[model samples]
Target: MATDGIEAVFLETHNWGKSARFFQALGFELDFATDHSSGRLRNGQGAYVFIAEVPEDHKPGMQVVLTVPDAEAFRPGPDVEVVTPFEDTHFGTRQATVRDPDGRLWNLQAPAGN
Candidate 1:
């Protein structure tokens, strides 16, 4: 269900810096960072997603983020499930999280300053 283009993808990790730097070394720019709950990393092109550490007791590696436009306007289509509601990020953008029937995660974000 790609609308415009690939926006952002998140990699959950216990170490945000390592992961963030890894992506940065690969040419991704750091747009913003947050430690409100879990740490987050955004790329230069406006693709900022998350990479959080899984709780020791919780299952690991079962989330994905699908980037979309106007996260607030995106409605649940078919098997989609809204996990996180659209809200302003500390980095100053509107973002939301959702899940597919398979439990795969998706993230929707509007353009910067939108």
Candidate 2:
């Protein structure tokens, strides 16, 4: 499957409200917000940012989300390492995590019903 491009940037924050405000101040308009736990924001054009509260035992970090034509059909080469198998998310997307050779984590995603 070919990658479409970056879908979104996922950020895990301890203080969701504060983090959302920080991004808003930077000119990212609020797209939709969930009860102070998570939300989606977009800048002019097509860039998007997704913020969510960090779960217990999870460290706050930035996750790069790449859009693929089909998440289930994306199979990394033998050199690439799979961190998490693809699974459907509550937000209506199938996602998987993989580690690059440089050890950076990337989230591969495909929109629902695609």
Candidate 3:
């Protein structure tokens, strides 16, 4: 299925302050932050970044989310790995997880199904 392009990036960090500062230094503006030490940042009209602080034991990583017009209709190439079927997210989107040929996971997101 054709995608609308990248929507946002989900990142895990060890320190919220450091991570936030790093992005801010890169011209990203804070959108909002939560008590759980996570927030969204963006630069102009570009896609935003959601950063979450994780325990030291939890390795830091980033995941890219691709915007799809219809999550249910999104079908990848035959060789693509569908790690998870479309599911409703607490953040208000319908998402599915898929692994690239390199074994990295990418999130496919679309508007919540009516």
**Candidate of highest lDDT:** 3
State the displacement of the C-alpha of residue 10, model 2, in Å, after optimal TM-score superposition.
Answer: 0.8
Q: List the residue pairs that clash in candidate 3.
A: none
The model with the greater lDDT, 2 or 3, is 3
lDDT of 1 by residue, 8-109 (tens): 555656556676777778776655566533455555556556666655576546344455665545566766677887778876777777776787667677
Q: What is the C-alpha RMSD of each candidate to the true structure, in Å?
A: 4.7, 2.3, 1.4
Q: Choose 2 or 3, whichever is better by TM-score.
A: 3
Q: Regarding lDDT, does 1 or 3 come out ahead?
A: 3
List, residue by residue over 37-85, the lDDT tens digit for candidate 2.
9999999867599999987688898878888887667767888798997
Looking at candidate 1, the ten consecutive residues that score lowest on lDDT are 59-68
Question: What TM-score would each prediction reach against the true structure?
Answer: 0.51, 0.82, 0.91
TM-score, predicted candidate 2 vs. hidden true structure: 0.82
TM-score of 1: 0.51
Which candidate number would show the highest TM-score if scored against the true structure? 3
In candidate 2, which residue ranges exceed 4 Å CA deviation? 55-58
lDDT for position 7 in model 3? 93
TM-score of 3: 0.91
